[model samples]
Target: MSPRSPREISVLVPPDLAPLYPDDPSRIGPYLVLGRLGQGATGTVYAAVDTASDSPGDRLVVVKVLTSPELDSADAYPALEQRLRALSNTDPTRVVVPLTFDSDANPPWVSMPYLAGERLSHYVTRRGGLGTGKLIALATGLAEGLSALHTRGVAHGSLRPSEVLLESHGPHIMECAVAASAERMRGAGATWLSPERFRGGTATPAADVFAWGAVVAFAGTGRVPFGPGEPEEIAERAAEGSFDLDGLPKGLLPVVGRALDPDPERRPSLREVIGAVIAVWQAENAGEDGATGSPGRDELAHVLEREWQAVEPPARVPQVIRLEGRMSNHRPGRALFLAGSVVVALTLVGGGVWGLARAFGPEEDGALAAADTAGERSSSESPSPEDDPLTMVVRFDPAEQESPATGPWLYTPVEPEGELVRGQGVPTHAEWAERWEAAGEPGLAVIDPEAEVLCAKFCAAPQHLFIDEEGRGTWELTGGDFVDYLSWGPVVIVEVTFAEEAREGDDTPREIVRVTELFTD
Candidate 1:
């Protein structure tokens, strides 16, 4: 937090391209240059407008140009481009909304959601230390966002304060700005980065947490966590250093310290870190006017209970239908696992008496099991509850009918209202469920808790990706199972589920339910 002047550096485009950009602004595709926002060692960013989408009502976007062809030509560019493009469309809760990527575009550009807010660095610079409430909100939101990216097999290589943007809702990390790559690490200032990263190691959740600790320190006292100096010096110190948080606020010190741990493996998981920070905030700030900390655990729990009770849960609805029993000799087994692409085929095959048409009901006790038993002609009923029928009825239209249906739906009723929660490297069923709850309560299709829980609405779109919630890669689903996937900065993967009921409120919702189960390999 050095009291340096807020410098707005302008980038002068090459002369030959002057006609494309009337005012010396770089031109790429259908975007109009406004002014230079900032610049890094390998790239320059501009606050530009999408001429294609700028017809009165269209929104603005910030375009980042990787000026150094050397890095772009290296192996890093392709992977970075693919990752960024994936994040933008798939992740709804992503702070950094990638609009498009054109490596062939004159400057090799990447367009993202033009966030109109102060950088986390600038925000702290202008307004000293953030209050506890705001800090808690910011940290919680960020941790969740990072968790989402990690779940998608991506790690934000860079997590500095400046890389984070503070928006009206919360913090939005800018993944492209850093333009992290293996070449960038090996070529130029690799020595200035963290020790674990410099040793040919990629980014991880633990490292992000460590950077987050530095961000907390910066927010508390305008200074880099590893002690401010030249960029290289700071990076070098961080690679082999630790932070001393003894003087910081009692509740926040632990978060700052744990995140700043030198060893990536030793640091707290994002879930653990968030839990600690949230607990501290709740304990100290609950009900106290202008207080940064929350109330005690019991009090906060009571408050949460009261709040939950106040908002009546949405009535259950039928979205998708499934069968539980094994399909006999005639067609597919009684319990059929249809490939996402084979919906119509399965419907055609399961018609007539063999088809068990079970209606969807709410999340009541025996409703699911009862629905599974609608059409079978078995007497002894050999299997118990665990081994009983497995048909799940998901009701998409809960509002259409009030009285409980005789059968159950395939999807579960998830509460999807709140800020988005990021997944860890791989998310568990619970983490996926939590993210669903945060994303305006979107519906979820737990395909195989033993395999991949078909999580919908991790961001704005419905994404379907397999995570080794069980830790063994044996259950991973490759490529096609998901409808769409979006990356938010470098911290989250927005799993796109195409079912009609997977709609979300305005902003992209992050669904961070199970972090321990995230798989990267």
Candidate 2:
């Protein structure tokens, strides 16, 4: 027989027909168990209806019953249950938060709002790869969910296609840290595991970043970057950086590439990834007009909503179960298992991973010193005024000393003879405005000819070197090609020029400028 295609094996099994063991509960807490939804090595999930609700049939929820021996500890269930309750109440749109849970039950169970949608894996298999627009929308939602988890010091250790549910509103992230713990205890691994995880490193925010990259790759190409294989083999490939990106969209390559980098320290933060992806989307659609031209948060959300509504609704409403029961006596043989689970969970949530700490160091002191040294070296190696016609050496004014309030140091323009102009501090926008008025707002000049110019043409603009009081700027130079040079030195030389048209804001009309180039050591 020929090998089965993804479409052939991708037939989704209905929840009603999912196998239900005789021991499965008929009822959990305030919910009536309806049918088995799915089962993993560590847990069994079920479709259920809220019996306590006056309108019981209006909506359904899911109940996950953990079977791992590691969760038998007296404290484990309570801690996990409390955390689930907090998450469910915090965000409903981005994540599938638990409505309630009963850690005290014989098999601790969590109830979450039943998502009436297919798993991301199923979607990819059935529909093939998604377009760039939809992928951007999905990535944005997942990034937001991860950001929320990270903000609370929680890491979605297992972020993969199976854990992402595509709903009408947006993509919902399910089974976060707790599921990761369960998988670890069961000795079941995923291809999306970061290289650090394969090396026995603890899970962290960076791990999520790696997994997020993998998820994005899978969604865009309809295949995992490392390809399908035994878990160990896939992990080894990932560690060796053997993934392929042939089918991934060009615009998404940068964000996904940095995310899947073997070194976790090199991966962009979740927030950074979000911004980068959004910028890519905006750039791709730059020719469009009005709201459609630029992809903002609202635009991404709208895309998600539209994609979600296009899919066929599930046959049955999803369910949630509020588990209710008392904690069973601890088993002597389960002590070690429970302890191991606790340690892993704590390591992921508390940011206690040994490799991460060592990679970044306990503090940034060494990194800062290294950056300063590199900056100095770059200055020394720069071309002399005689060799480079455009080269201009500048210094800070001796009389106007730089204070903490003055921000970063500024250099003065030097002549071909190596002559120094009067030193002056890099001024703030307010100070620049004052200087502009003092100089009678003279036309932009290359050389001051007289005293050293305090704030030169580009430097004097609000959007160039200084930000407004609201901490907003027309351009952001944090990531992508702009910040790549920052790794070599502490300072970057950027050339800013005024735009053809000015932007009228609520407070005042401001001169907008474009950042033409960024040069680093």
Candidate 3:
């Protein structure tokens, strides 16, 4: 539903602002109206609780009464409710799935889990633009939601900041099935309407893409992409290509720009949009090990915490422990001596050679071994490659490579603890050489100085890799040249073959040749 005009008093607020109104219904089928959540052109949503449930502190739900003349018909309610139920059963990752619906009531209404959060418009208004990671998370969720609907031949005709609810987990698309048909030509901001919709075309999936871009622009800039004006004025401005995307993150600009393309046919599909967003997110959060995965619920929580702190500074907890009685006033002059003694004791007990081996061995090797063991145990229980939910594949173009021509490039993770690494446009030849020399040039891989260097802005795309039991690596890129690489960020992957030095416990005497592949996906 469209957001209420800025001049009107907002009924959406914390519990304090959601008091019951005289005209509001006390009961909606099995649900008891707790208070008014918000009112829109189509209907008024109320905070509700299931009256039949005996449990105390029952989870709240929201019931939207279909008061609009166009949507209140008996025949329309059944079809709409059925569509919503089907959409809800399709997936729960992208949208706020509907709980139930009542078509037999005096006024048909639909129930959905009550998300304790504000609309995207209010969030941007209160907190300004979201950080890159949080924005990516939101974009990913919304795109997935749209993808789910589009796959089922349903379109979210109205997709705007007002239709998005920002919650602790991630942003959730609201009023999916019902709103698509009910509010196809009304109850949406002008800036979010696609050119096709304005020209009397039906709301297609592409139109939803256009609206998605506009909403994203609004989130990033706290202003509509087509500038501010009346609905008609804004539509005209959009037709004239007057929208500005200056404030969007560099990594997201390309995707958003393409989505906002004046020609609806030029806009990328919802799945493609999601891939671009993921690519940017992976680059930003990639760890030193070069393994990449989608951000988990924990990351979303972190974003929520930051937003919360921005609106209301967290109260500082008082320090309960005092150092006065726990330690002597005078600093210990023999601190160095004590530390030295401990080191000497360790060396003596472990042996000088063994101690040196511990210090010199690759620190990550042990962790990798542990991870391998755990992965082996879980692999059997995990879905097969075909069924794997996380597997993502995109075409790789060798001609788009961006690194310099040099000998011996090293591959490393973006963050020490990160699983995804950029493998496409990172560590130019010069950078690789510096790292190689510093690491004592242990690998057999040679970089050829005379090799041609291919560089392009769209060289690096986010990828996911799978390592087989034999330690062979395979990977898939997530975006392409048509996708904006600048907004997606840069990454590189390199493979090195080297002789691993034998340690004291090894049965083999010395060097054993091994192939090591480094990737950012």
Candidate 4:
């Protein structure tokens, strides 16, 4: 099946979308637009300044301004806004945090806590699998985040890797859809299956699981879950339960197989898949006897390391190359997937998935794997350190703490309070610090609500090379390509930690791989 043209999937208006806002940019109620972050199919996100308190400018927020005024006021989308608001109130951690909901504006907008990080696409392309430990951390945290949404009777509907944000805080899911019922829903909310959704079908948790599998596929191989084609074609193949899994790691075969099941009912739940993946992760890291026999874990780890280094940062001198790409080229409501390939190409290079397409694309599916490598090589370059901040490293510390009521806590230096013991890495302490420092002193910070206590749940920390006060450019690594579900931006990282007493109980440590570096110049 041929890929659909851009005009087939969605339409894009001119960049001058801000004029629709009738109110002053600084005082939308109590929220202020510090800078324009990015726009999505449904809304525009701006880095907003919360002027509700004394330290008005100090409080940062992501204000999601709806692009269409009619959609906001119409009764057709009744439960849409209400559903998101409910999600925020019931499960604060389920989706991103929504601070305020206001329909007073021409196009209603919501103010949410600003996420500091890059898009997951950017991070994954720049950095390959973050080792077994990091992968476990990310997957587990995201699972909990998913669980939070599910518990609230909300299905992410869209659970693609690009939609998942890997923030300094942790991995987070975004783009909740109650409004999608108006059109159609199908096959787990993955964009590649949009056409199939229009046929009165609804996206279920199982579909979400399948898309999660695709996310894992991209994370592991840096390729699409299925062969590259239009949304209809991909859906057709997915419905047939046919996928190219030759490039997937043998350890992940079982999980991928179950996730891609043609029958949604046959697919595992997100919780179950998370358990299975976590088990695989544990086994993979079990050392000598415990490591899976499929491939040399050390060799794979090294390959991933090289891939991470290949994502050259943009040039030190910032020069905006205006690409005359058309968002409107893809048809609105149609499956324009050539763009998916392009998205894959761009994100893989950006995430540092070196030779990923080459490793997994063609030899596995008879597609042009070389094409992806060539594309990545041609366009990949280190982002400019000047004008924009270069995100060096992102670390999630479940142990980090912050004062309460201060709102979103900021990044602080990691103390490394003997967090690691023997049998973890480098086999000793001396090597651990060396490795940590070499990795660029990555630490964790939180945005918890504690009156006087130090709560560590909502922490965001990034290794910043150059901090930009202008706030014009977003260092976006993950979640940059998708819309914000809970808050103004997508949830890049979602984390849940348990105390020692509860560790033996149902509560255990959870880590969501956060897409880091959204805020830069």
Q: Which candidate should be chosen as best, given lDDT against the real structure?
A: 2
Residue-level lDDT tens digits of model 2 in 428-452: 3234322211211212212111211
In model 4, state the lDDT of residue 46. Answer: 52
Worst 10 residues of 4 by lDDT: 360-369
> Candidate 4: misplaced stretches above 4 Å?
1-24, 54-58, 68-73, 90-94, 103-105, 127-130, 177-198, 287-521
Question: Taking the tens digit of each residue's C-alpha lDDT, what string does model 4 give over 123-214?
Answer: 56545544554455555555666677777666665566656555434556655533344143332233334223434456556656666676
Query: What's each prediction's TM-score?
Result: 0.47, 0.55, 0.52, 0.49
Worst 10 residues of 2 by lDDT: 339-348
Global lDDT scores for all candidate models? 0.43, 0.51, 0.49, 0.41
Best-to-worst TM-score order: 2, 3, 4, 1
Q: How many pairs of residues in model 4 come into backbone collision? A: 67
Deviating ranges (above 4 Å) for candidate 2 = 1-20, 56-59, 69-75, 177-188, 292-296, 315-521
Local accuracy of candidate 1 as per-residue lDDT tens digits, 188-272: 2332245676665666666667667767776766544665344556566766665444445679887667667667777889889
Residue 1 C-alpha lDDT in model 3:
82
TM-score of 3: 0.52
Off by over 4 Å in 3: 1-14, 72-75, 180-188, 288-521
Candidate 2 vs candidate 4: the TM-score winner is: 2
